[model samples]
Target: MSRWRRLWSVPLLVLTLCVAGCAITVPSDPQGTLDRARGGELRAGASASGELVTVDGSDVGGSLAGIVEEFADSIDAKVVWTVGSEEDLVDGLEGGDLDLAIGGMTDATPWSQSVGVTRGYAGVPGARGPVVVLLPMGENAWQAAIEAYLDREVTR
Candidate 1:
């Protein structure tokens, strides 16, 4: 193999091994939120600070919006959007009124300390910065499923 390819493999291997070493234990309930989301609704919050989360006619158009739509499609859930200020959205997520919060959240964003943040994704256009979604701060099965989907959809 080329030297460049060989060099990349070690770090990739280490990362894979590290990820494999840690496992999340999902509860065994089939009717839990994670499982129910398969054909249920996803309550989501978004700040009306930018185009990334909007009430633009009939569509919510933005990088994070796209991610939300994709997540909803994956689990057969429809996004129930609540547009408001960042504080309001974050409050909603904390209060169990929102399953996901989408905005221009990024690495080093203050929300990371207050809420559960997904791994940042840099691929999407119109992201003010590397974007991460907010979930409640816990290891619930629902958050795990959404994080897994984002690891594939955004990180990949």
Candidate 2:
């Protein structure tokens, strides 16, 4: 190949590689849950599950509640809690009325088919098994964000 042709090809290859490397690949969120939650209200459903979550009138408190609040703060969002039974929370998640649900849910939760469940994290007081947080189905970005927060918190 000619010298000029070779020099031009090298620059072009480098540019192509740089562009490919810089490309962002965001996770899919069909319902835009994460987008809406950022710098906004995070609709969270809480079920009574012992120390993992406690509901007193409109107030929610417990280990899991603290974790959820911290996670919401990390994203510049405020949590709007809804207290209900496990079934009701799952229904809210399925219907897109809640961004997340936490109530000492475990890996063995039967509502997995209807919602997105985070990977179970251990260490919650009084939890029967690894505890999980549930989210709306197919909100991959939202699920990932919550899971990432849980991963960091659970490890600490």
How much lDDT does each candidate structure score? 0.74, 0.89
Candidate 1 lDDT, tens digit per residue, 116-138?
Answer: 78777776666656777787766
How many Å off is the CA of 137 in candidate 1?
Answer: 1.4
Residue-level lDDT of model 2, residues 8-117, one tens digit each, is: 99899999998897755668799899999999999999998888898889999999998999999999999999999989999999888999999978888898988888
**C-alpha positional error of residue 134 in candidate 2 after TM-score superposition, expressed in Å:** 0.8
Lowest summed-lDDT stretch of 10 residues in model 1?
24-33
Predicted structure with the largest TM-score when compared to the true one: 2
Off by over 4 Å in 1: 1-32, 49-51, 57-59
Please report the TM-score between candidate 1 and the true structure: 0.72
